[model samples]
Target: MGVEGGLKCVKILLFLFNFIFWLCGLALIIVGILVQVSLHNTFMINDAAASGVPIVIIAVGVVIFFIAFFGCCGAWKENYCMITMFAILLSLIIIVEIGAAIAGYFFRNKLSAIVHDSLTEMITNYKNTTAEFRDSVDNLQKRLKCCGMNSSADWKGFASDGNTVPDSCCLNVSSNCGKGAMTDPTKIHQEGCRNALETLLKNNILWVIVAALVIASLQVMGIVFACMLMRGIRSGYEVM
Candidate 1:
């Protein structure tokens, strides 16, 4: 094929790649919002804190969207300046993402310990905490079918209204079973919230790593296309 035809093909491929890249960014933004909403009312007793994670994710998504826009424009116009800019930005993003993925790998291993500590703290402060916080913990227990941070023994230390455990810790959702179940270990949840939360965070981190790698691969392709298209544009200029 001629140079013009090859250039056309490259531009089309670049446009399609950027369009999909932009969609990935949009998906990331939605995921970030959902995560933030899910964890909004929940309390975190960790020293590192969990509050900023969703915000950072949202910001990364926004930045990706803008970078993809630059890529799309560069390909469409076959502009050397825009393509060079896009390539530079994409390279920087890939480097940052690699670092993030590495950090996530180590973070995943430590998540269980951190969550264990956080849950223990939450259990300690449960009664003194607000109703919303209390409800959040209750919901977690109910959904995970677990009790306290480690065992029902964790609730033994809590003395409030003569109840050993919350209603959510019962075998059934019956209010009558709640107090009585505390005495009968068989009637209460056998597992603990710490284990449940740890499992959940591990799964989340895996998905996050997978997603980052996928996006990074796409970004690499974009960088290649941007450079090739820039070269083609310069060649065409010389031919003219």
Candidate 2:
């Protein structure tokens, strides 16, 4: 009787853990969408690697969501096969998640490396792109007080003139102050935008990495409860 009662509690705990996993999946989806919007729409950073971050988050969330639902159903039905499958699937997910987290950790610094390329693409195609995109790049330069991805010289040939930069790169807010003034230290900012953009990416991704590790750690408890319940069911005991 005591063993049955303990198994019942384990079953209940597994159910609750699955529910938590469901909620966590939803949260991750929301976070991923918001980050996606912020990085792509707001910041206009369309870098391949940078844009992929949110996509992977959403994918992981979807996987977790489905697996959580499966686990719930398996627990509710007290099916040993279903429960074992859930455990196996969840173990695979945990491995994938741990790998992702470790990759994120290593890639945190490498993320900044692409900033130069992304910014250069934007600046090079500034006029060819839509007005909104132009405004976004201009806003970034102005807000960061930066001229180009690497240096003010990046704006060479940006205009019909031999050397020029956008007015946003000027220390003083004015029209056409950047024309032929790329090398004028007093006229415009010489620093690159890499530092600013890199900082933003790193800070945001750091939180995501931390949250994933925490959730992964908590999932271990659910796995334990699942295994315990599976044992009770497999022994022909009345786990229900």
Clashes of each: 0, 0
Q: What is the per-residue lDDT of model 1 for residues 77-136, given as tens digits with 9 covering 90 to 100?
A: 777898898889879878866665676677777777777777887787888988877888
- Model 1 score (lDDT): 0.74
lDDT of 2 by residue, 35-78 (tens): 67767775687666676666777778788899999999889889
Off by over 4 Å in 1: 35-46, 49-55, 160-163, 183-186, 237-240
Candidate 2: global Cα-lDDT?
0.82
As for candidate 1, its clashing pairs are none
lDDT on C-alpha atoms for all candidate structures: 0.74, 0.82
Off by over 4 Å in 2: 142-146, 150-153, 160-164, 167-191
> Residue 5: error of model 1 in Å?
0.8
* TM-score of decoy 2: 0.82
Q: What lDDT score goes with residue 232 in model 1?
A: 84
